[model samples]
Target: MEHTRFARFGMVCTVDHLASTAGLSMLDQGGSAADAAIAANAVLAVTAPHACGLGGDLFALVHEGGGAPQALNASGRSGSGADPGRLRAEGHDRMPFQRDIRSVPVPGCADGWMALHARYGRLPLAELFAPAIRYADEGFPASPLLAPAAAVLPGVDAALAPGDLIRRPGVARTLETLAADGRDGFYLGEFGKGLLALGRDGAAGGSGEGEYTEADLERVNADWVEPLRARAFGHDVWTIPPNSQGYLLLLALAIADRLDLPRDPSDPLWAHLLAEAARAAGHDRPDVLFEGASVDGVLASAAERRATIDPSRRARLRDLTSSGDTTYLCAVDSEGMGVSLIQSNAAGFGSMLFEPATGINLHNRGIGFSLVPGHPAEYGPGRRPPHTLAPALVTRPDGSLRAVLGTMGGDSQPQILLQVVARLLASGESPGQAIGAPRWRVGPGLTGFDAWSEPDEASLDVEQGAGWTEGLQERGHPVRGLPYGGAFGYAHLIDVRPDGVLAGAADPRALISSAAGR
Candidate 1:
């Protein structure tokens, strides 16, 4: 197990060491938690482009000292020219898959940074972005995690080796522009032109047209909304509301909270119950999470579902789907401010629609939209796709911040978060112990199209050494052994003790993830 880093002043935990260092530097420079999180995320954009970048969506849960936590939904909407009808006529039944330009949405990462900075930042934009710009322009050593993924991008050397020095001049220039001109530097400037050009060139494979007008780009803004809350393990859990699959985490937790979960982490029955709860949440998500749907009813139904879980046999769901490539990080300042942030490109290299002018790899978030008419996530103009980026925060009953945590696992995100949170709260595990524990995910398949495609039954993917493996198998779970390191999600967490001490941990699944503070 990884050792937890403890600090009295501040803490920053992220999936990459360089990014974690960048965030720590921000905190040392007297920046707030928001500034630290944005700095870390910017570095991730430069270092881990396959998972997140300027061409992505972001969601966050922010909590200030003695104040209620707030949620930021910075996911972008589908273009005004989106057309589900044309896709249907072309014989498509679901959303377009990744790699197609039509699957790209208006990126909301830049706007998210701006919104976060506007509300809680103490440093200038240029200062917050300096580390990423320097790394992009002067070159940084390629990480083992990034080498193979970067090789797949256009123009990248296929034989790229870990530690090789790599530079992105165009991306550097774009970051410089963003630092100098704020959000306008991206959505209304040269970067925006390059995006429009790609659409006009009909680079959307054989699809009709990839139309993204200035309106779609210009109208992109982050919204600050009330976080959805659920009481579990004597603490209140908060997450980004609908449009984000975060509610799944809450739903699963609610069901588990109502059930007589075993306190032993090694208990096979515990993992089985959690997996069943996850399957139930995944099965019901599509039916309850569309635009204007009442999540209260769904959350209220958790108790009803809790009674159906059979300890002796796995509860099977009719259908389920899950997938994603993303990054999650957390930062905490001396003043009791915490930020749980998540960002993603939807899949590896996103839509793979790299814009030459800006060095931006556009995201395939639009792929989350459905093609079925009248569906909540149906492809349409000015609609935000159902997103998997779910960041979460927890507080004591008296409203004191307790923890800031999250992970990146696409549809498996909530399941991963559930494991970590349950360990941290219900089992009283330390941050390091909780984050380093073996994890399980409920999904249709392990990889490829089948991984994200809707399937008749869901499988439970458990880490190879999990003590409950045989138990889960005997309980009728479709148990699949996942090799340790990289198969599961990379989670980062900051546990706030009642004494104001911060304890943080970064998952070992990521090659260079770290937790640092001073």
Candidate 2:
């Protein structure tokens, strides 16, 4: 088991050791939690490009010393030229997922960094970007996670073994431009031109013409909105609102709280109840997950669903779609400020379309949209698609921050977070203990292709040592045992003790993840 790192002043946790180090450097330099989070995220873009990069979107929950946590939705919208009609006519009944350039949403990471910095940065934006720029310009060792997707990336060698040094001068120059010109550096400059060219070329190859435009790029900006809140486990839970699937976590927690869940982690009943709650919450996603949709009804419906769960039997639930390769990181500063942030390429190497001029690995977030004419998440000009990036914050009833936590698993993000949060709040587990415990995921079992397709039969995939597979199977669940690895997702967490000490943990599923503090 991993040991939690405790600190009096600050802490940073991420899926990569180098990224954690970059964030710790910011905190040491007097940067706030937001600054450290942005810095660390920048490094992840360089070190873990297969999961996240300049071309992805971001969502975060930032809680200052007092009041409720704030939500920042930095996800970009489909281009003004987006045409569901064109895709439907071309035989696409659902969103295309295999290297379809039409699935590339406007990149939002650069703008998101600028938005966060503008709100709570004590250091210059350029300084926060320096670590990433250095790593990209010089070289960084390739991680095992980056190897599988390397073939789709331009500069990265497909044959790269773990620990081989790889350099990305193109990405370095793009980062330099972002540091110098802020949001304009990527969206309105030469990088933007490169994206336009890529879009045109991709369209010419049967995707339909004019699927991108300058207006779409120039209009990009992160929006600050109210977070969805729920009371569970004697504390208030918070997550990003719609357009992001964060409410799924809140809804699941709400359902679980009403049920008589077993207290012991090893108890078969505990895993059974949690998995049932996940299925209940997932059932509401297709109807309640669009941009501008209200989740209040879904959250309120949790009570009714909770009453339907039978401890002696598995609920015959239909499966929800899942996909993604992303990064999640969190930071807490001395002043009690906390930031739970997540950023992502929709899938491994995203649209698999690497722009040569700027070296941007465009994301396929548009794949989250539907082609059905009247669907809430139907493709439309300038409309945001449903998202899987869900960052969460936990606080006491009095509004004092308690924990900053989240994970990267596409549709599995909420399920992973639900397990960790339950351990911390209900079982009183330490950060490391909660994060290191065995996990289970309930989903449709397909990724990177037709991710948002209609519901299929759901299956339960439990980590090998979870020891509850037999229990679940006996209850009628189609259980699949998976060896410990990324199938469960990489989660990072920081628990803020009432005494002001911070304890942090990084998931072992992430090969080089770490929790650093002073």
Clashes of each: 0, 0
Indicate the TM-score of model 1.
0.96
TM-score of each: 0.96, 0.96
RMSD of 2: 2.4
Residues 1-518, model 2: lDDT tens digits: 86688999999999999999999999999999999999999998988888899889998889997779988999998887788888898888877785777788888888888889989999998889899999999999888877655655676556778888878888889888888887887898877888887777774343546678898889865999999998899999999998998988999999999988888889988999998898878865666689998888878888887876899897654532221688999999999999999999978778777777867788889878988899999998888899989999999988899999999888888989999999999998999999989999875447722222332366677897889988888887878788998878899999999899999999988878989998
* Residue pairs with backbone overlap in model 1: none
Best by lDDT: 2
User: Which lDDT value does model 2 have at 76?
Assistant: 90
lDDT of 2 at 414: 90
- For model 1, the superposed segments whose C-alpha errors exceed 4 Å read 206-210, 319-323, 444-456
- In model 2, which range of ten residues has the least summed lDDT? 448-457
lDDT of 2: 0.85
